[model samples]
Target: MKARVTVMLKNGVLDPQGEAVRHALGALGFDGVEGVRQGKVIELDLVQGTSQATVKEMCDKLLANAVIESYTIEMA
Candidate 1:
């Protein structure tokens, strides 16, 4: 089995890295680039019987910062 986690910053939090990318895009002649937000994807190889509950617990403990970020999980 495999799993994926997508983690992103919550709205209203400043994303300096994303902002920098946006600025660079404009400087490189990419016009009308209004905004940019950055996020991460984590791919996991798991045992066949690993439960969604366990995955959620993993996110709560380590994968995401609950105070400022959110995460979604997909299993395959």
Candidate 2:
């Protein structure tokens, strides 16, 4: 079984790295680049029969910082 997680900062949060990327793109003449935000995708292979609840617990405990970020998990 596999789990894929997408983690990102919540809206209204500042993203310095994303801003840097946007500025770099503009400098390179990549027009119409208005906004950009950065996030992370994590993939994990776990033993079969792992519960969604456990995965969620993992996210709450280590994968995400609930104060400033959100995460979604998809299982296969």
Q: Considering every candidate listed, which one attains the maximal TM-score? A: 1
Task: Give all candidates' CA lDDT scores.
Answer: 0.95, 0.93
Q: What does candidate 2 score on TM?
A: 0.95
* lDDT value for model 2: 0.93
lDDT of 1 by residue, 1-76 (tens): 9989999999999999999999999999999999999999999999999988899999999999999999999988
- After aligning candidate 1 to the native by TM-score, how far in Å is the CA of 37 from where it should be? 0.6
Model 2 misplaced regions, further than 4 Å: none
Lowest lDDT sum, 10 consecutive residues, model 1, at 47-56
**Considering only N, C-alpha and C atoms within 3 Å, which residue pairs clash in candidate 2?**
none
For each candidate, give its TM-score against the true structure: 0.95, 0.95
Model 1 root mean square deviation, Cα atoms: 0.7
Candidate 1 Cα lDDT to native: 0.95
lDDT tens digits by residue: candidate 2, 5-76: 899999999988889999999999999999999988889899999988889999999999999999999999
**Candidate 1 lDDT for residue 23:** 96
